[model samples]
Target: MLIGEVARHSGVSTRMLRHYDSLGLVRPTGRTVGGYRQYTTEDIRRIFHVESLRSLGLSLRQVGRALQDPAFTPSALVGDLIRQTEERLRREQELLDRLRAVEHSAPTGWQDVLRIVELLHGLNSSSAARRQQTVLTSAEEMPVSTDMLAAAVLSESDPNVAGALRWALARAGGDGIARVAAGLSSANGDIRQRAVLALAEISGDEANAVLAEALENPDAAVRRHAALAVGGRGDTAAVPVLVGMVVEGANDVDAAEVLGSLAVDATLATPIMHALAGELTAHPADPAVRIRLAQALAEMPGTIALAELRRLATDPDPAVSLIAAALAGVLEERAED
Candidate 1:
């Protein structure tokens, strides 16, 4: 095949084939009567091979080495290509996300676009202070998109920054609850905790509903935090977990306090009292459990809690008796006033 015929058949341009020839990548094996480059079957096959390698993201130099160097292995180069492609994809995805955030912000001018971009960069800064400052300044400068705030709060690890983000999310509340709810389903425990923390700060019914769902989360910390938040909202559904918290001694003091507050409701008071009393029955031998139960009884209100404390005051365990005696005396003193 002549040069033109080779270009036509191989789908490579004549100019590129000449360039390949100059690079010693492919050369015609024969000469025509007019001294034109005439390619043989073998040369045409090598041209196809070079094009195929190029399609796999191999550089021209890499293609030459692949074709000529017997020692040049494809495995290592292919691995590198895969890594390079992954990095490029990650960068592209990040850019797409930034563009979407900017687009969602609905910037009115190039200045608005610039400000949103700068604010986003600051929110993602490595320094916690910078992220916090960005959140603090966001409201004064302009309304940040809720999704952006949600993303920051969900992934933020720094306590101060996370608090600032959560506050901003609450103040900026549109779809914030829904976005944080997505974080509830994340595989990362820390992310889920952050999500619940943010949800707890948000005040609407939607946020409360998400907190209710989080009470059943597999992570103990998530469940505890959710229970505290929900119980604070006077959701009677949190009573069981709050009681379990008292039994397990996980934030038992705060859990006990919340349970006491829940007992203000007539419907929940007896059940809460029974749940606390039942824990003592379930673990009669554990003095530590008994002591914790006694302490919990002190936080509850009304004649029922007073009577339970009086009963516990005479218990077999001296520590339980002493604490219960002290708590009963305090309740008796308060009741007298």
Candidate 2:
């Protein structure tokens, strides 16, 4: 077959076939009387082989080496191609995300688009200060989409930058609650904690609902954080976890305070008291646990907590007795007033 016929059959363009010939990648096997290039069946087969390698993302040089070098093993080259393809995909995905963020911002002009782009770049910067400044300035100067803020909140490792992102997300209202909520299911424990922290900062039914869901998270820290946030919101659902926190001495003071606040509701007072008393009973041998529980009781309203405090005042452990006695004295003095 002549070069044109070879090109037609193989789907390799004539110019490309000539280029391949010049590079010795697939030289014509013969020539006609007019001196035009002519291809044998084997030459056409090589053209198809080159096209096949190109489809796998092989550069022309790599393709040539692959076909010509008898010792060239494909394993390393294939692995390198896989990594390169993955990197390209990652870049494309990032570009798509940026475009979506910009589109969601609803830019009125090129300036708005540029500003949004710059803000996004800053948010993704390696410098925590730049990320924090971007969030702070964007809130006042331009409207950032809740999606971007929520994403930043979830990924931010720097405490300062994370706080700014959370503040901006909270100010953005409940719009980003679902995105932040999705982070709760991440297999990463840190991400789940971050998700709960962000949810705590956001107010509204949506955030509260997500917080309630987070209360059951498998992670103990996530559960504790969610409990504190939801308890402060006056949700009695956090009672069990709050009680647990006091027993475990994990932020026991805050847990106790939230419980006391919940106890303000007349209906919750008795159960809250009983839950504390139950923990005390369950851990009788553990004086440290008992002492933390005794301290938590002081936050409860009504005579029940005072009665519990009075009983603990005579406890076996001197340290427990001393702390409980001090708390009991304070409660009695309050009763007198």
Candidate 3:
């Protein structure tokens, strides 16, 4: 086949075939009287092979090596190609996210577009202080989109910056709840914990629903955070986790407060008291656990909690006995008042 025929037959352009010949990648085997480039069957096959490698994102140099160098293994080269392709995909996805965030902001003019872009850059800055400042000082005139704020909240590692992002998400209202909620399903425990923390700051049914869902998360930290948030919102579904938190001494004071608040409703008071009492019974030997439970019971309202507190007042451990006696007296004095 001549160059033109080869181009037409193999979908390889004549210029590219000539370039390939010049690079000694696929030289023609014979020539006509006019001295035009002529390709043998094997040469045409090599041209197809080069195109095939190119389609897999191989550079011309790599393709030449792949075709000519018998020592060149495809394994290392293919792995490298995979990594490069993944990096390209990640960059493209980030660009798409930025574009979507900009579009979601609904910029009215070039100035608004620029401001939003600037805000996005600050939010993604390597410096935690810059990210925090961007969130805290983001102009009311050009509010950052809820999606961008939620994304920032989910990925932010610095505590101060995360707090600022959460506050911004709260100010943005329930709109960012679903985006933040996506972090709850992340395999990373830190991300799931962040999602719950952000959701806790966001008010509304949607955020509350996500918090309630997170109460069942496998990560104990995630569950404790969600339980505290949802329990404060009067979601009784967090009762068990809150009780567990009190028993485990993980943020037990805050957990106890939330449990006490949940017990305000008359119907929930008994179960709340019973759950605390059950923990005390379950850990008979762990005096520290019992003391934590006793303290938590003091937060509970109604006669059930008072009775449990009074019973704990005589506990064997002097520390438990002393604290429970002090708390029971406080509860009794309050009842009289």
lDDT of candidate 3 at residue 223, scale 0 to 100? 90
Residue lDDT tens for model 2, 1-337: 9977887888889999989989999999888898876898788889999999999999999999999999999999999999999999999999999999988888889999999899999999999888888999989987689988988888899999999889999998998998889999999988998999999998999899889988898999999999999999999999999999999999999999999989989999999998999998899899999999998998887555888887888888899989998998888888888
Put down candidate 3 lDDT per residue, 1-337, tens digits, no spaces.
8888888998888898889988988999978888876998888888889989999999999999988889889999899999999999999998999899889988889898899899989988999889888888884555788989888888899999998889888988888888889898899988988998999998988888888888878788989999988988888999999988988889999999998888889899988887888888899889999999988888886545777878888888898889999989988888888
Model 3 Cα RMSD, 1 decimal: 2.2
Report backbone clashes per prediction.
Answer: 0, 0, 0
- TM-score of candidate 1 relative to the true fold: 0.89
lDDT to native, each model = 0.90, 0.92, 0.88
TM-score, every prediction: 0.89, 0.89, 0.91
Error of 1 at 259 (Å): 1.0
Q: Which candidate ranks first by lDDT, i.e. highest?
A: 2
Q: Which ten-residue region of model 1 has the weakest summed lDDT?
A: 296-305
Which candidate comes out best when scored by TM-score? 3
Which prediction has more favorable lDDT, 1 or 3?
1
Residue clash pairs of candidate 2: none
